[model samples]
Target: MTAVEEKLQLPRIYKQTVKMALYDLCIVGAGMMGSAAARHASEKSGVKVCLIGPQEPKIREIVSGNEVFGTHYDEGRIMRATATSPLWADLAKRSEERYRELENLSGVQFYHEIGALTVGTRYGQFIGRTKSSLKGGPKGYDNVEILAAKELNDKFPYLTFADNDEGIMEKSRAGYINPRKMVMAQIVVAVNQGCDVIRDIVLNIEKLQGVYKLTTERGKIIWTKKVLLATNAFTGMHQLLKNPVSYKAMPQTVTLAAVSENTAKRLSQMPVVLYEGKGGESWSKTYPRDSSDNIQFYLLPPIKYPDGKYYIKIGHSDDILKGSLELTDIRKWYSGKGDEELEEELFKLLDTIFHGVRFENHHGDACATMVTPGKQPYIDLLSPTLAVALGGNGYAAKSSDEIGRIAADLILTSKWTYDIPKENFKVKFHVPSKL
Candidate 1:
């Protein structure tokens, strides 16, 4: 039989496994990271890999039994190489380099290289760390332009900024990515590389003698030698991790402003903006309400959503609702509109930034971001056979490809192969306090 035919027949064999199909590596959670790791791991010769996760739900109101959700269901996510942390900068730069190659190979288009404008106070901590991260960054990353307040207004008249706010413009390899399409592209490449795609949520995982037996919500049994848990915010919901990873699943809300096609066309040249600090005297009063509520937010240019309409999406850099939500409350949280007060504030902020812009209507939605204590993803092994790649902290969507590659390398070789320190990605467990 031809190699193509052989590859096509493998899934049939896997599905017929009343004996429990065995795979070399099984990755749970087929979101951005999981899909990317599946593609990378499947590239290894003679290795059998499978990616297991549920497809996006059709209804947002109800999440059935064991049905999980992902944060990448949106149309646009910001992509920028200039970050406050050097580690995220490296990961984003590396992933940005592969955007075109992945696009060409998978025949999928997900990246839009319009540019990115980051605004902050003249000597703000965020802007300072962003500048320091560029000290020895990759080539072409140093081609950023510093713009004064007047210059910022002149360049992007559609945006409004405080007089004290300075701007850093990354003209190359920066913009927004359609995360849903990116995940689709990654899974396409993975399947083409001989990986089986299982559309089911992993209900439970029990370690067998030398392998792990994964039980799916649909009752399919999968046995794999090594498992990678890329479960992100839903990590606490799964029984896969023996010692729970130390992470907070905080609630996030985003407001989408729908605009006419003409408005979208007029603002087509608008770059993604990350604004730090107050908007103005009136705007400042409504924002930065407490220590947890920083006056920092980001917005994407008009992007077409699945509904054949265009919207300008905006959200705060951190959680709008405070505190880590209980894992049990996740499904209900997804069903309802996130914090009504924050949604109102977001619309007010949107109107303030875009002063005279016309909008048809606006609405809010809810999602969660997995935050680690150190503000970095935990990409370490839990045991000799089980590994993890959780904790996006609101920055994983853009750098997911490289993060997935690192996760694949760790599992395939059983060692840290990346240049960055493994200690930086060390996994921490949560120990509940006894009353």
Candidate 2:
């Protein structure tokens, strides 16, 4: 017999078609939230969880190509306890506690305990509201310090603060995290706990005989007792239900700049800084001239990239170019170079804040943040078997672990069980469009 024929005939069992797989819970979109849900469901809920999503690109360089990129595929994300609302702050605190346990279990170091600073005008309403929400002393925060402008400048001399600006610093459990690594670590732990991870795009979801059937791009099928749509930007892209969930995808851009080794070292001890813009001011009027304005900007600490050069990432709260985007529009934007005007603005902002720190190579990428009309995540059951955990409002990354746990709990028990108020995360149907 020929070698090929002999090999083919060697094991008839090996050539047999595999049986269809069934999962207790099937999660789509294995990004930050979905991966954590898979891990929590498999480990804590003891369910047969299967996670489905495309593999992260090996090369994330800002190149021209036809590839869909994720917002969380970055070196670092700012994790802080200072939020506009107390519920959000509590969510961040809860997720911070879980970060330690996840690191120990997965043996992956992702969270950095450096610290975080939220700076605004001394009398700004933003700062006042944040401080008020964080009341109850240490019960609400860990070693929180409200620093005056002079005090902030004294501690972080490299940063430029307006004379009237003040900062709120959380001394513990606040800093940045390697979002890409954190997602991978969650998947690692989930797989170790008997969760199946699939690298495929889900095309459609349908219900047949009271079971959720997920159809993948590769023509594979999966049946699950419950389905969780943790997909962020691509939340309503698929026809997952008879009546699709509604969400608005707000496209945003982030710029990354590679600084000199000396500058990186100088900024090594600087905490994550959020330059809270004044309520209604322009960047040109607020930044170089004064640090108080309505142009919100945030900075992540120096993190080493694949090229061995440390780059500090900066993102604006308001998009330089604003509009609602669909999944295809977001993918097309990601396939091309980022916005030049936005990149230039970010570089200028960085230079102003860091006192003329020259950035060597600057590049940027496009990502979309989903938001409901109410500006909170919608975690509710679409049907008896289909549950969705969509809408981050561009501030959900730091609290994704708890959000994911909430998603899983909603799927397993068909109810919201987290300590957070159900109204904060409850899904609102038939809401008028904010666009």
Per-prediction TM-score, please? Answer: 0.92, 0.88
List per-candidate RMSD values in Å: 4.4, 6.8
Candidate 2 residue-wise lDDT, 195-287, digit = tens: 777777788887778787888877988899889888887765664554445667776776788998898887887799887755222134433
Q: Give the runs in model 2 whose Cα sits over 4 Å from its true position.
A: 1-19, 44-46, 59-68, 137-142, 278-293, 319-321, 429-435
lDDT of all the models against the reference?
0.83, 0.75
Kindly state the number of residue pairs that clash in model 1: 0
Give the range where candidate 1 is weakest over 10 consecutive residues by summed lDDT: 8-17
Q: Candidate 1, residues 215-294: lDDT per residue as tens digits?
A: 98888889999999999998878656755778888898889999999999999989999977645443535754435334
Candidate 2 positional error at 331, Å: 0.7
- For model 2 the local lDDT of residue 243 reads 46
